[model samples]
Target: MSIEDRKQKIIAEFSMFDDWMDKYNLLIEMGKSLPVIDPHHKTKSNLISGCQSRVWLQARYENNRVYFTANSDAVITKGIVSLLIRVFNGLPPKEIIEADTAFLDKIGLKEHLSPTRSNGLTSMIKQMKLYALAFKTKHDSDKKED
Candidate 1:
């Protein structure tokens, strides 16, 4: 599905809950479903620096798309990254980099988060976009050489 479709689905899911606690429970449930990150990628290189909790993310470029796998020591952070991966995974690098991410605001997630967690969330998005940029650059260069 397209990122917008995925985002809308999430928005609909969140709308079903009338309280933030319910959202937290939903996030925890989502966290439980996050795939375990490869032990090899759980290194300093993949650690997102700004998060209060440790988050490790790795991206690979294949067939002109960027695939991501990640882990976070904090459950809520894990869910946050999982959501991002859902939107970004299997998408072309340029599309990943260009995604607007307004769904985050539409769902009221950003304002509802604690300031530190919100910062961490922003950092996570930045890191993902950086990875997409790197992949896009490499792919563009390869095309130039072709």
Candidate 2:
């Protein structure tokens, strides 16, 4: 599905909760459901800087798609990253690069986070885009060479 559609689905899901605490519990559940990253990928290279919690993100480009795996030391932080990965994973690099993340505001995720966690969320998004940019550049270059 398109990023917009997936984002809308997330918004709808979040809207189901009238209470922020319940939403937070949902986040924790989502975090628990996030796939565990390979221990090998839990290195400094995959670690995102500026997060109040330790977050490790890894991406691979395959057949024009970017697959991301991530983990966080904090459950809430992990949940945030899982949400990001759910929106971003298994898509072409250009799609990921161009996605509008305003749905974050729509779901009140940004307002709900602590200042430090908010910064961490921004950093996670930045890194995901950076990976996509790299894959896009490589794809463009490969096309030009053909």
Q: Global CA lDDT of candidate 2, please?
A: 0.88
lDDT per residue, candidate 2, 1-146, as tens digits? 98888999999999999888988898888898776789999999899998878999999999889999889989998998999999998999999989888888878786634456436888889899999999999899999999
List where candidate 1 sits over 4 angstroms from the true fold: 112-118
Residue 117 of candidate 2: its Cα lDDT?
Answer: 43
Pull out the clashing pairs in model 1: none
Residue 15 lDDT in model 2? 94
Give the Å shift of residue 65 in candidate 2: 0.5
Q: Would you estimate the TM-scores of all the predictions? A: 0.93, 0.93
Model 1 per-residue lDDT tens digits across residues 42-137: 999999988888999998888988889899989988988888887788999888889988788766587624456435888888899999999889
Which pairs clash in model 2? none
Alpha-carbon deviation at 43 in model 1, angstroms: 0.4
Q: Any runs in candidate 2 off by more than 4 Å, and if so which?
A: 112-118
Shift of residue 32 alpha carbon in model 1, Å: 1.7
